[model samples]
Target: MIHDLLLEREQRRTISKLGLDLMITPEGNIKVVEINGVNSGSSGVRELTGRDIDLEMITDLAQNGLPLFHLGKLKDQVFPHFVSELSHQQLLAQKWMHPRAPQKTARFVLPIVPESSDILEGIIWNADSDYYVFNERKYLLINPFAVEHAAGDKSRVHALFQGDLLAPLRPKMAFVVRANKECDVSDFKPNTTYLVLKPTDEMIGRNVIVVPTEDVFCPDGSLKEHPLAAYRRREEGWYQEPNVIMEELISSKKIGSSRTGKEHNGCMRYLILVESDKGEITIKHYGGYWRLAPSSIQDSNLQRQLVANYSNGAIPEHISDDDLAEVRKCVDTFVPVLYRRMLRLPINDRPDDLPLEAYCY
Candidate 1:
């Protein structure tokens, strides 16, 4: 149901790989929250080893420098940023690969310079540049052109509410707002309830705030400063970003959930879509987990952690079997359609590139 949002080239530079985030309501509705890239999922090997497991990628890049390309000053910014991140990772890998031990106990001794190897050769949309460098170089990104114009945007997803197929699964209402203009919570149904506010471009639950309609404004009747203003101000000075999302806060229904019988506020379902050699698409059920809201909204110490973004490490350990299955079914049906739309877009620069066809099931 997503549509395109016009953006300038500089604004589009950060577009990377796709990791769609979805919320499962108590009534069994599947609603898309947002999309992301370079989120907090580590590979199985990295998890087991407790380290970045792709030393071969670093060795190859340093030994045989691959062609680096970017739009405008991106190359200047991206190249150095990646080199520093990779260099730090490489040093750690080198340390672990060699240890002061008996010859028999020593792991395979890696040389000062790593041997070159071939990695995946393809472009990754909405990718994290630094993370990509240590992961693998074979999948050399074609840069700039591969980024889908507005792939992971909340604005684009909000516009999709009009589509018939998504209407049932979507939220009752949502809209965009800027920092300068305060939100009119009275427009939403049950004006007495809370509303979900999120910064459009931010990820990892950085600036997501769930506040009651009345609490949003100050005692003096002026709009309160953003929840993230202090932190963001320290980082980039006093400038309110003009784009934020305001949506009807869907109160998650209590379920006979968890082995402990304690109720959770809500849950998140993560789904992934991959393309095969013949341009076939496959939707994989990645992971589903529960998320809890703040216990006391009035307590300033309590923060409403609405987004269950993996990067923020907001995973709930317990979920009932039925809840998991229902979410899975919804994801299996919904993701293929999303992938099909993605395939229709021009996602590659190579002539041999093929569009994603039917779902592989």
Candidate 2:
């Protein structure tokens, strides 16, 4: 569809050479998915737009610098071609609009999503929603990355589109909020007990997915991060972040490290997992080539032991006294500094594996 957007000749060449992908929404928003062989003459990168271009209106990029659109050919619905962030020099393109996530200010949920990764909460945001940019109906951008599904759920993680957020709910399970459901201030019922929520695809009240305040501090399990993202500088020295550690665990080789041989690089992804009496929990994010503490998960044998027990809803071991002390120290030291997103329980939908009696709001 980008070939039809009013684009410069250079932009078309750049998009073509890389086999890049672009997305246009029914609301006239545009997005760029991937761009390789970036334009060198454009000062490392550049953004092109005519203030706005109608995606359903045009089939080719426009060269006149004016938005080119053929609204007549588009479905009566509005269509956005793509969404890009404005930079002084240019815009970065993306595929489909960045979906919107529900974000409320309530500090209700305490425990949260606990890993570091680029998470995609399917089709949760929109251009015309009640967000910072109200009514304009645009895709969204979540600062930290994450992806979540119902707790204990074993179902397909479908990708939802922004234009279709209001469509009939198609959640794999009963967690979906029907498209016609309506919600107002009364939707948030008071919590008698501290609620714990498991991520689900369904949006609450209506077929709208909201970013719950539940502790979305980390992400839902560990997923692989791109190899090149290991280059951030921390206090100790050049180091990979906790999410990088999770990726190292998933990669073909040590993801963050560019070392030649897999000799004793000694990178391990282990943690002193903490669960609270209140059912709230905290994960001291420490996984890396440079470990801050000894490996709580010494060998694959121990890892297996923990996994087996966790499957049955049990804690693995006492956690060595030294390890305990180190974890305590780490929590005390970094809990305040660690990034966090508080989520309330039972906000989205019931978790499949979680006991209905427990973690209820």
Candidate 3:
């Protein structure tokens, strides 16, 4: 099941790398919260420590100038290829390699990619569709398209797991509009019940809001603009905001160094690898990380939202092996279903794998 899913191809090439964001609920259920393409770069270290800890900058120290590291099929094995950034000096040095005495001072040439075409590789820290389109033979650490499918939409991605597989891992989520044609205001609780509104395409938890459903509509039965809409920053700008996916609030136990050690809401992150070879796929468990918070998420105030994403002051912590075992079970059921739904393929389709019910409109 894993092999067929990973090895499936579009056109003539297989997806090489994928980055996923997994979350563990308060009740200890594991769920996939987001997926990222190869274009995903780690800002965890930077955000956690406030330093330029990019791999490219570190690798530049070896005089290899930012070469791409290809992870082998086996974990822990990596291969390096020289791909250097473009520079004016290098361009001039190439132009006047045999300069006469009039231009004898051309010796300041820096190390660069031997082939000009590889220059693009230096500019990219992670693989994207463009990276695969440009270099087919290069091995990637993960597949790019899988990342897009997993992280692209909140409503769609969460809907896929509404059934037995990771169903317990999911919170109460739904696609909601400003005015519900069927749902009446009586069904909403003014302050006790909270719903998290998330933009479909934004990242870094930008434009995410947690609000009381009652506030979305006015007494005149018309939709009222959410106050956060005016003050929040978004990937596509404020006025151009896309439709949102609203989920009922699920409180998580404290998973961080809160002053009171209160059971504040939090999420756990797991990193794993899916490797493919000769039409076979296998998932390797790398380990698990964490993101914790001191408060329940809120967005109505237009302040920095209380998203548990690492960027929002979430510090990393240790998770035990027992916790990882639970996470593994969720991924085992999730990956195959995710591959099937996203690709519309039956690589490892199971009749029982169908979502228990349609989760969204």
Candidate 4:
């Protein structure tokens, strides 16, 4: 479903690569919890599985070419731009020293240097010359705006799930409301035991509040303090109501880790690559990895076991052959539906005025 949407946009001037964080229920149902665009992790998968997906990606790019980096002609020149509020020195150090740094394995691409980077609307400019500098080597920046729309916000995903195409694949959402507004706790589904409150665009499991529905409200007909604390810390004032999605909490199936000999609340990260060539589009499953929650399922803290995210201290686990086969079967079932839906939908969002050329440096 997401691949088709991304492909339509890629046919225009936009391109996207996806990393889906999925929760596999105890019943073997696959539910998508999050979709990451260009900022998704490939290095971590390499570190865990010893599979160089980055190399595969670059190889594919060279042959087919993505929207911005045409014909893989500039594959060697393109650099992954990391956007954050960190200081220039700090960012540079991370790019070079981080254990999972892409430059360590994907040597074709150079690390980014702050001195040569010039921030623009969607593209980065090299202040000194046409080439960007890192370790005294020159490279080009991938246009950030080219993949911006591919980064689906939670609200967008929620809205998409409202349609029949993706409804079955998404968890049951209770309601989507602005954080500052007074939400009626009674509106939640009667039988729903647990609910997840998540900010629309926050990543790495930040600002996500998961609690039992029964504890959502105080006895005196008021909202509980714990759930509201994340929202209150915003400096944008109380009236700045960002969209918050309240969905039924999907319990992660327990997977036993061979290394630890313990069962853990786990999630799966499946990477999907969508590439557009001369008017043709292709989609491929670039393999996947499993993430075990920081604590085991036996942990006393329910919240700690619920969020299985790498940034939140979760670690990667090897996916056994049996587990991989099961997931592949599920994904195979889902892909055809996605392709059928893509064929039915008209490409309406592509900008006709823009040239169908790569955004080269």
Candidate number with greatest lDDT: 4
RMSD of each: 13.9, 23.9, 12.2, 11.8
lDDT of 4 by residue, 224-298 (tens): 654555556645454455567777888778888766788998888877665433345455678778888877888
lDDT of 3 by residue, 203-308 (tens): 7666666675556656553546553453343345455446566555665544544343433355565544444434444565544455655343432432233466
Candidate 4 to native Cα RMSD, angstroms: 11.8
Candidate 4 deviant stretches above 4 angstroms: 1-15, 65-147, 163-165, 182-190, 217-242, 276-281, 332-361
lDDT accuracy of residue 219 in candidate 1: 51
* lDDT scores in order: 0.42, 0.21, 0.46, 0.54
Residue pairs in clash, model 1: 15-126, 16-125, 16-126, 16-127, 17-125, 17-126, 17-127, 120-138, 120-139
lDDT of 2 at 27: 38
Report the error of model 3 at residue 318, Å: 2.1
- Which of 2 and 4 is ahead in lDDT? 4
Error of 1 at 93 (Å): 23
* Best prediction by TM-score: 4
Residues 27-84 of candidate 2 have per-residue lDDT tens digits of 3222221111111011101112121122311223332133322201222434453223
Per-residue lDDT of 152 in model 3: 55
- Say which prediction, candidate 3 or candidate 4, comes out ahead on TM-score: 4
- Point out the higher-scoring one by lDDT: 2 or 3: 3
Error of 3 at 18 (Å): 4.2
